[model samples]
Target chain A: MSKSQLNLTRIVLQDLWHNKWVMLLALLVVLNAIAVVYTSHEGRKYTSQWDQLLQERDRLDIEWRNLLLEEQSRSEHSRITRIATKELNMNRPLPKNEIVVRVP
Target chain B: MSKQAKRKQKPQLIQWRLYVVVGFVCLMFTSLIGRAAYIQIIEPEKLRHESDMRTLRTTSREVQRGLITDRNGEMLAVSVPVKAVYADPKVVHDKNGFADMRRWQALADVLHEPKEDILKRVQSNPRKRFTYLKRQVTPAVADYIKQLKLPGVYLKPESRRYYPTGEISAQLVGITNIDDKGIEGIENTYDDWLTGTPSKQKVRKSRDGHVVERLDMVQEGESPNDLVLSIDQRIQQLAYRELKKATEANQATSGSIVVLDVHTGEVLAMANTPSYNPNSRENLQGFRMRNRALTDSYEPGSTIKPFVVAAALEAGTIKVDDIIKTNPGRMRIGGKIVRDGRNYGDLSLSGILVHSSNVGMTKIALSMPVQELLGAYQTMGLGNYSGINLEGESAGLIHDRRRWSEFERATLSFGYGLMATPLQLARMYSILGNKGVLYPVSILKLKQEPEGTQVLSPEVAQSVMEMLVGVTEKGGTALKAHIEGYPVAGKTGTARKAVAGGYGEDYVALFAGVAPVHNPKLAIAVVVNEPKGDRYYGGDIAAPVFAAVMSGALQMLNVEPISKREKVRLAANSRSVE
Candidate 1:
């Protein structure tokens, strides 16, 4: 080999030996960057799932409110009273007609 | 071999062409780097914003108003999901939304609107952005409209308030406007507590409109809270039915009733006659919408007499058994003639109330200082708000003048100079039954018993309560208010309404009382304004309503009949004697 080319190879070997720790640190940084990208992707996937669950909760809440309204409409006090008095032939007993037995 | 040697001699020309091509390639690379730098450093926001606009979105979660329930958890007011159908006129015109005439006909039929009217509303202004075709349509109707697939017609979510009990509890639960905003009664007082803010969030979405990531929250959301009132719907319905029947039978102008729990100071029922249905607003009048029990005040008439007697007893002016002369009942005071229905001879304190003799009350008032009488009235919660926290409450006016007159004092003792609402009278009776402890009235359901102020001694209050019992007995003025198995202690008042210069011909019939003299569970007041028939007296008109409501309410509460209780007491007493 030529003298200049041989001298260059020797200088490169010396520099690599001296800066081995710096090269290792650079490799770790590259790995950390890749890990960051992987974690963010997973985070987004979980967030989408959580959002869907939240939507389901809202939908269930709405259903509950609607059912409550329907139940109230069906069991109105006036309607019950009307049915009891008119359809069922019911009446409140007078105080004199009611006989109380002591339950000693 | 000769040709190859010649081509090799021209190698300089080949090197020149190669240098030119390399130089051109380097120049193109430099220009590409320059453009990239310009976009990244010099002006990147525009392009970044354009990209974000296509992917990022601002989404909001909608919230509805909370519910209002009774003490028993019965729904008084509820919010149901609905939709508002709106049209973008410009979009309709551009998209030829009117191409399908059959769809327009169906839309008009479902909305209950004339086709021509709706078409004109949309076609009137093509540039108009938004116009409501129909508001507060049911979700079923909204789904039908959605299925039509008409362009430019969109459905927006909304809420509507529904009252299941209709006019039975309308005055108390109140009504909301078309936009689900509270405008009256309990709804108006707690509007902010019932309405909650919607949540806003920034999010990133995929191409097909799926949320990929939640960026950040723009505004925090709060879930709406529910309100539970102190009213018992059963008693309210009973009272309203009874009051409505009485008002119509007597042909009275108006009426109001208030029922209060003696121990908790909670209002059990408040009903008014001429109440309108909150669901339908057609042909509604302003007068029928008022909650007269809290808003209107009239002279208390003889209802104030019991308070005066209590004050006299507290001041030590008269003993419970002392005899007061009512013979020759008509008396003149300060150039004014004060007379009773008839002359009642020497009467006890109980007899005075039974006969409802004004002469006896006038003499009792004269025996004490005017301040003592007024002080007694003030302590009983007269001339003050009931602390119910409702809108448009009337703290019935009491004269605060510095000067005093014997006639004014006499008039005040008979309940002519003072004015009070039906709710105030009920509160006074509640104090009487609660052993002279005055509790603040509450419309909202209370978690614990509130602290009370000691206004009167227990002994004086019990004595007054016992004296009031005779007012509902056989010979008493309010015999109709007597319950069969329970002892009722109440007073009747028929006050002449004051008009322009002097008293008018109209009379306000009132009965305020507490029942089951042993435990005193409830205090009720019934007021009927201006009966057109001859039966205009408080004992004739208001007493029967009080009796019906009181008996029904007592039975519902499971209060024991006084007869059985007295029998048990007698058995215990005999065993002790044995």
Candidate 2:
């Protein structure tokens, strides 16, 4: 109601309209809110990806062991010996020539 | 004009709401388009992975094949753990995979192996999945392969068959293929049951690879059945070693020895020389694979003489002690010469048999009707399968009486035209050894046939059995076959092989005998085919091997010596008498 108070109110109104720096800051804050939500969702997606890879590794380990047993049940001695002696350079002892060396 | 003014002043609520509805539809359409684009193009793999995560891909865990065990738990054959190296040709053949190839070559060089071998293994495997490099690798070798960490390379477990005692009962065990399938032997006969069928099991696993639940219908394969043979390992070893020595010493074509229990009729041991190691099956000799005792046939010579003499006595044509004058070493019968070992004057039937007089035997056979003689041979079990367990068993050669030649009849009595396997011969004598009762032969089942009938009269059997004992006594033809502590009843036979319808210079020597005459235990048939020279008589060549085998067999059975003093006395008495 007084003349001094009326003059102060008018100055405040003028400053509010003229300040672009504060308005820009408010706009940036709203943009950052949207960015934060999107980035968090992406973080969760990658976390699940790492989890899926770990499962695959475990699956492969089990598969490898099972395949080994299957291969084992099917192998034969004659074939194994052929591979061992001819391919691997292992030799079987001759009955007539084998001699016992006394172990000290 | 007044109505138009009122409508313009108040905007219609329906039109305003229509604008809001269109805006909402546009927003929904935009969202749907964005979703389609994401699924189809922007992140196809990502979406597909998301869909696949709900699905579970599983495999079965393979169990190792079961083993075969023997009766006494002696490892006749077994499967041992081993490794096979394999490679994926597709991965190996990649264009930029040459870098890995160089690394592989360097590793192979460090392991002291040629790179060519590694390359060959890689090339051998089909590119689709896997190829074998080597099997039965040692721990150290497998470790080296693992350390190399070669890409597309893997190791697998495998099994190999091993026979502990080499070439022992090779025919009985049969053989197997590289895949552990029973290709031959007992393995083939019982393959499906031995290699159990596989089954599928469904299980839910946690994302961390821990199993959470197992679904129904998952079945593990059953193990193979165990087989216990009716053979004794110790007895088999005895026969094998002795036959090996005899065949080698005589430089004969091959040799066979079969020892059977007279009462039980169990073939305790069947051994053949010139056999191959089952572990190394390639380059096997046909002769080695043959079960000669059960498959091959030859003339019995004087060994069959006793059967005819026994037949005549049993038929009431002559008594055990009846006397007959034998021609001097040679006689012409049916346009063929029947020869004895030496000249003998008039002697009792039993004495004639003891000396192995072929001339006397021909006279006896000629006197009897051919029908009765043939019937007696049939009853004695010549020309019939002994029902052995091995493949390719022969029943020997027997010509019918309707087709008999007069000379053939005369020679057949003294074991010329009639041929029999060593097993058949031993089985025939086994009837005599078992008091004229015959039993069926089997390798799998240990049980015997129902109580057999009396083939010969009990008195006739006792007398003939008593007479056969003379062959192992001082004046008997097979005196060399006598065991020290136990009394032996046996016959020695040496017949020339008939080549081009006449006797060849080479002869087959055989000593078919039964030991512990008082109580017949084992009946053995020892056969040496085509011995080197003139000294190839049964008593000379085959009897020694018989003694060695019989000795080992007796010890193995834990049979007590009848008398220790008698053993020494008999040896002294035998050497002196000879």
Q: What DockQ does each listed candidate score?
A: 0.44, 0.02
For candidate 1 chain A, the 10 contiguous residues with the lowest summed lDDT are: A1-10
Judged by lDDT against the true structure, how good is candidate 1? 0.88
Task: Estimate the lDDT of model 2.
Answer: 0.72
What is the docking quality class of candidate 1? Answer: acceptable
Best by TM-score: 1
Tens-place lDDT digits, model 1, residues B82-169: 8999999999999999999999999999999999999998999999999999998998899999999889999998888888778878
Task: Give the i-RMS of model 2 in Å.
Answer: 12.6
Candidate 2 residue pairs that clash: A72-B157, A72-B158, A76-B178, B174-B185
Question: Candidate 1: TM-score?
Answer: 0.87
For model 2, how does the per-residue alpha-carbon lDDT over B1-578 read when each residue is reduced to its tens digit? Answer: 69888878966579878889999999899999999988898989986777446544353544334445444444456655456777787886664344666677765665566888877767664466777767666546777888777777778866566665558667556667677777655566656656655455555445666444445556665645656666676677668877887888889988899888777777877878777787786887676777788878999888887789778877777766667888467888667787776888776676777888877887788778777887888788887777665567788777884777667778788888788999988888787778888777766546446456577766676566667666777787776787766677788899899899778898999988777655678888999999885589999889888877776676556555555565565444433322
Segments of candidate 1 deviating more than 4 angstroms = A1-38, A92-104, B1-44, B334-336, B403-405, B563-578
Leading candidate by DockQ: 1
RMSD each, Å: 4.7, 14.4
